[model samples]
Target: MRSPFVQLLTARRFAPLFVTQFLGAFNDNLLKASLGIFVTYRLAEQSGLGASSLVMLAGGLFITPFFLFSGASGTLADRTDKATIARWVKLAEIGIMGLGAWGLWQQSIPLLLAALFGLGTHSTVFGPIKYALLPQHLGADELVAGNALIEAGTFLAILLGTILGGSVVLFDRGALVVGGVGVGCAIAGWITSRQIPPAPASVGPDAPRPRLLRDSLDVVQYVTSQSKLLLPALAVSWFWLFGATVVSGLPVLAKDVLFANEQVVTLMLALFAIGVGVGSILAERLLHGEVSARHVPLGGCVMAFCAVDLYLGSLGRPRATELAGAATFLREPGSWRILADLVGLAAGGGLFTVPLYAILQHESEPSHRARVIAANNIINALAMTVAAVVAAALLARGMTMGELLGLCGVATIPVIVITAWIVRRGLMKGVVRLVLRVLYRVEVDGLEHVRAALPHAVIAAN
Candidate 1:
């Protein structure tokens, strides 16, 4: 049988959206990674701050617009064809990339930051449209698989972007190259966006346009109306907090803790991205299409374990006078363990977040779905911002990157526990079945054995 992802790709409905989203992610990460490396190596001294601090700053800046514009994005998504919104966003990327190109070529930090903010706005505009489009186009049966594919494609794009972003900067006139890549990818994404089939408007044109303050209050009221939904949404946000901490910490972690160079940084990023992608794809099979928050507690526990392992692996290791290149780092003792920790952590993250996205899409009222997604984006952005701020503070206090990550891992436990407690009633199997209507359609071959062992047996299933 063809795999779910294969089937998704074969269908024209899903395939174009996938490519468009993939390209958008690739462009975002490529610009961010390149800017990060530049800030790390070339401009930290001029800025009078550490490279890690600068990275966190850039990350915070890039995500800030999501908080500011997500509500408006949601309004747009609900009000019009999602594909049209996506196209406009992608077209806007061309100008943003041009500004980034100029900023990079001139080594102008302020201009580059402006470009970053612009890119963030671009992403904010597209965020609600992308997730909201999925449920409209795919069946409930395909929700997990569809989301898995998007998550997988996205992180894989991140992986490639990280590698390319770091490698290209090693060349002469790397700034120009980074700028060129940004524009090219944006153009490609826009073209792909054009190919996406039009999505139906969730809100009719004659539907009264919501005022900004009203929109925000309405979303909050809707989210709070169902406290159960609120918890899952927060759980989703916590994933971003956890992920942003680890990813933003990696470059410094590689350089300071592992005593490695950009290539090793690239390796760490790619490994983590790969792991998340694998875990996202596997989530569909692991749960056997039974979508619920049942797997989240386990995933969070695994992430904590990996985080502790990472800390232990790097603790008390000697810092090298000269940074090790990727090859040399790979040969060092404890290198594989560190790699494993990164991968494991990312895999756990993938497991933790996918079900929540499915829940958000499948459970929310269709009329308010995009707005809910926008709420999610706002929460994700705020959580990431908090992570960045906390991480920055911890690093400024002379804490090692490993220790900060360990703290992040530890912090995750309570959030997961609290979220689990809030959604505990849904943890039961029967509740899960009810929560997810027609969750799965699986046929087991060995059912006769169970029947023979005990006729009319009381069986519990998900």
Candidate 2:
């Protein structure tokens, strides 16, 4: 039998969506990475900002849109056909790329930063539609497999984009070439999106139109009214926070902690990405074609353990002022341990996330599912923002890179434990039950009521 990824890639319903999502992800990273490198190497004198600060600023700008727009995006996804929303978003990407190209041509920092924000806005709008589309298109049994493919494809896209962006920036006129590539990816994504069949709108045409500002403000209330759904969404957000923290620490770890250069940084990133991709596919196989929460605790523990090990491996390395190449770094003792730890951490992360996504989709009511995803996105953006702040504060306060990483690793344990506690108390079921009892005033005695109402109910709180 063909692997799940291959099977999904060949299937009509999934293939087009897959390609579109992948290309979008690819271009997002490509733009960010390319702009980062260009600013760091080529415009350092002109920009008057150090390479590290410029890159950090770019990262912040890219993620800021998600925080600002995901709520409205969720409303849009729920109010219209997801495929239609995707098409429009993809179309917008063409113009966004044009802006980015202009930025590159002019070598303007402000324009480039605006492009980054624009790309992030594109992603925010697409986020709700992408996840919501899967349930409408795929069978319940295929949910895990579908999410696995998207996650794997996304990571692979990031890896390729990062490498391509960094590599292209080395050549003369690289910015123009990068801009050209961005336009191409955007065009390709738009073409693929054209092929996607119309997906169900969460609300009926006769239903009262959702007010974006009002609905966005109500997301927190919606989440709270369905208490069980809250944990899974928070867990998803936490995963982002965890991943961002690790990533934020990497450059420092590669340079100061490990005495390795940029190539080693690339290698370490590649390992993490590959590991997540491999782990996602592996989780699908290990579950015997089912979406189960049983593996989540195991995965969370594994991630925490491996991250700690990574910190330990980074410690007490031989003192050398000179930067080591990839090969030289690999030859040194403990390097393998660090690599293995990173791979293991990423794999564990994959295992941890797939089920949480499935849980979010499966638990949410159809009409509110996209909105729930938007809430998750908002939380994710906030968590990541907080993580960045925390990492920066810790680093500035005389903490070593390895020690900061180890702190984050240690922090994961408590987070996982609290999530597990919430899950065990049957909070997800309780969320549904509470809605039935309070809103519909129906007597709900058990988890059965919650599960029965999950598919069709439009959850709201007075």
TM-score per candidate, in order?
A: 0.87, 0.89
In the range 1-462, model 1's lDDT, one tens digit per residue, is 888888998888899899988988887888888888888888889988898777767877888777677777787788888998888999999999889889888887888888888988888878889899999998876888888888889889988877777678657999888889889988988898898889988887886574664665566667868865687788888888888788878988988888899788878888998889877877787665556777787678878889988999998777788999989988999999999999999998888888889999989888888989888888777788788778888899999999988887888889778756755776575455655655665444665566456766766776
- How many residue pairs clash in each candidate at the backbone level? 0, 2
Clashing pairs in 1: none
lDDT of each: 0.83, 0.83
Q: Clashing residue pairs in candidate 2, if any?
A: 228-427, 228-428
- Candidate 2 lDDT score at position 310: 88
Q: Which runs of model 1 end up more than 4 angstroms from their true locations?
A: 39-57, 210-214, 419-462
Per-residue lDDT over 1-462 for candidate 2, one digit per residue giving the tens place of the 0 to 100 score: 777667777888899999999999999988888888789878777977788888888888888777667777887788799998899999999999889988887888888889899999999889989898888888776788898889888988988888888788658888889889999999999999999989978787775455655666677568867876787777777778888777656778999999999899899889989888877877787664565675676678888899899889998998787999999999999999999999999898888888888878888889888888888888788889998888888889989888887887898898778866755645465567679889999873454455567787565544
